[model samples]
Target: MTDRIQEFFRQRRAEGRDLGPCLVVDLDVIRDNYGAFAKALPDTRVFYAVKANPQPAVLDLLARLGSCFDTASVVEIQQVLATGCTPDRVSFGNTIKKERDIARAYELGIRLFAVDSEAEVEKIARAAPGSKVFCRILCDGAGAEWPLSRKFGCVPELAVGVLEHAHRLGLVAYGISFHVGSQQRNPRMWDGALKSSAAIFRDLAERGIHLSMVNLGGGFPTKYLRDVPAVKAYGQSIFRSLRKHFGNRIPETIIEPGRGMVGNAGVIEAEVVLISKKSADDQVKWVYLDIGKFNGLAETMDEMIRYPIRTAVDGDEMEPCVIAGPTCDSVDVLYEKQPYLLPVSLEIGAKVLIEGTGAYTTTYSAVEFNGFPPLETHVI
Candidate 1:
């Protein structure tokens, strides 16, 4: 956490206004993260994934930094455009889209689209004729914290047919794309996907359709309870894999970073609601916070992402505790399977700081769940 955020909480407490869980995002951190990504992949373009965090201030900052956008919906596209970014800099990255949305995006000057099936290609060709379309292939999401497999991409062979159908239907078969997974910690994971992409490139070239680009989909991770590699490490590994797989002719490339772009730039401050035990003989105490899965900590689902939580009594004696949220839902518990270690002196009304939460919290927050308002956000 930054000093500015600490001061914000201090002032709020001084005014007796630190009443609810809120997220504070530091724009300076985002600016530095953008510069790091740009430097790491100098030859490749950076497309900020709007689904990660679509705050207006975040969008405006990235736009001014000369970053393109990967939007999942028309509303996200509009949010990016509201920052004065041209439609040419935005890609409709979602494969499963309504034909009407494709038409709408085309009307809005979006010429780049993602596809995984011939049906999708046909829709795009009919809606946005001659637009650039890239086919996504499936990758076994090995070594990723939150694996993104099975739902989005087609097989490599199917991708070829989809792109070929797009070519026949008057669409520009642009290139190949694959996501290694989200929060992938292994830098070497890009090698296998790049190898598949190279094979697709060669197969299409033999059929007289030469591709020009490869969308190296985002898997870059942000620091959490466990440390992750630096962006430069991923960049070097990816560059080396590109040379090994597609020698002499590295196609024009781009990266879509969501978590790595903004996950570390934000922090959440939550108040301890209650501290209790289930039974008289129970050794573990249940510590409930004002924030929960429905509010701002949805990433804790399946215990995949364990955020680093800090409190004023962190330096005191510690013990394992069952952490939960202040909700009536039975599944609101965050650390039941793997209990979190916290100070034994932690009590009700204590304020805790959750770090590395800049990307997904605000966007995932629910509105009026349990009569609790959405996660309030302040961009500094």
Candidate 2:
């Protein structure tokens, strides 16, 4: 906590104003994270998943840092283009195919794509003839703690069939891909996915469909509130396995990192709305902030497990408090039972800050249920 953040808080406090559960981005932290990924995964084209946080400033920073774009929809493609990314540098990485979305991306000169089914192959070939594509395989089915097998992710056996169909359509079936689920806290997950990739490449050879690229969908580990697997080491171990199994026949690698790049670089600042306790016997002190689940940080409302949070209370009194948000929804709780400190004797109206709202906080939110305007954006 440098004066950079502290100064921002201090300035408003002096002006008789408090930050109202506002989200802030730190360009320095983001740049360092991006640089670390680029350095670790040498020669691999890095596409910072745009859906994570498509703030104009965030995208602009990515472009300036030489990171590519991984977008899943037509509008996402348009947003990447808006951030000045060249078409070839962007991949429409979602396996679900929308005819109009494919056409739209093709119109923007998007070359690389990903798909998981025969229906997708038909639509892509019909809409964008000769487009290069990646067949996405389902790693762990949706029945796990998190299930993504619902709409996309072809099974490994089905992947061979899909690749065969792709080759027949005269479209360039460049390679195969698979996302190993998100918020992955374990390095072993990569081992499972990369091993599957090796098997797929060999199967593709047996089926006569050679690929030119291998898209390993992002989920390259990030620690939130708890220690998770290390990102750089996990990525390297997987890369080593891919090379070992496939030799030089391994296609060029591509990755899409969202939270790993921006998760730690942002924080939220909210106003203290209410502070009270349950009852005489129940001594769980609660402090409510103006920022609600829908407003300040919707990630939690959606049950998004973020990093362990550290709090900043306006005054210098440090005591444990149950921090909540201002949403009308009863389920609008943000952080509970987590050790958060507020000044011992705080005023009725105080301000609080929560860390790590960079990834899924802004772009994927519905913040204006009551006509509340979005907060202003600054590049500091």
Q: Pick the candidate with the highest TM-score.
A: 1
Maximum-lDDT candidate: 1
Indicate the worst ten consecutive residues by lDDT in candidate 2: 141-150
Q: All candidates' lDDT scores?
A: 0.93, 0.73
For every model in order, what is the number of clashing pairs? 0, 11
lDDT of 1 by residue, 16-95 (tens): 88889989999999999999999999999999999999999999999999999999999998999899999999999999
State candidate 1's TM-score: 0.99
TM-score of each: 0.99, 0.88
RMSD of each: 0.8, 3.1
**Candidate 2 residue lDDT tens string, 1-380:** 33466666667668965545566678888898888888878878888898888888888889988989999799888887897878988999888767988988898898888888988898888888898988887777321223344466877888778878878997887888887776665555656666777787788877777777778777764556656666678667767777777777767988898888887777666666788888876556787877656664666644456444444435466777776766566776766746465677675575555666677777554547555445433446
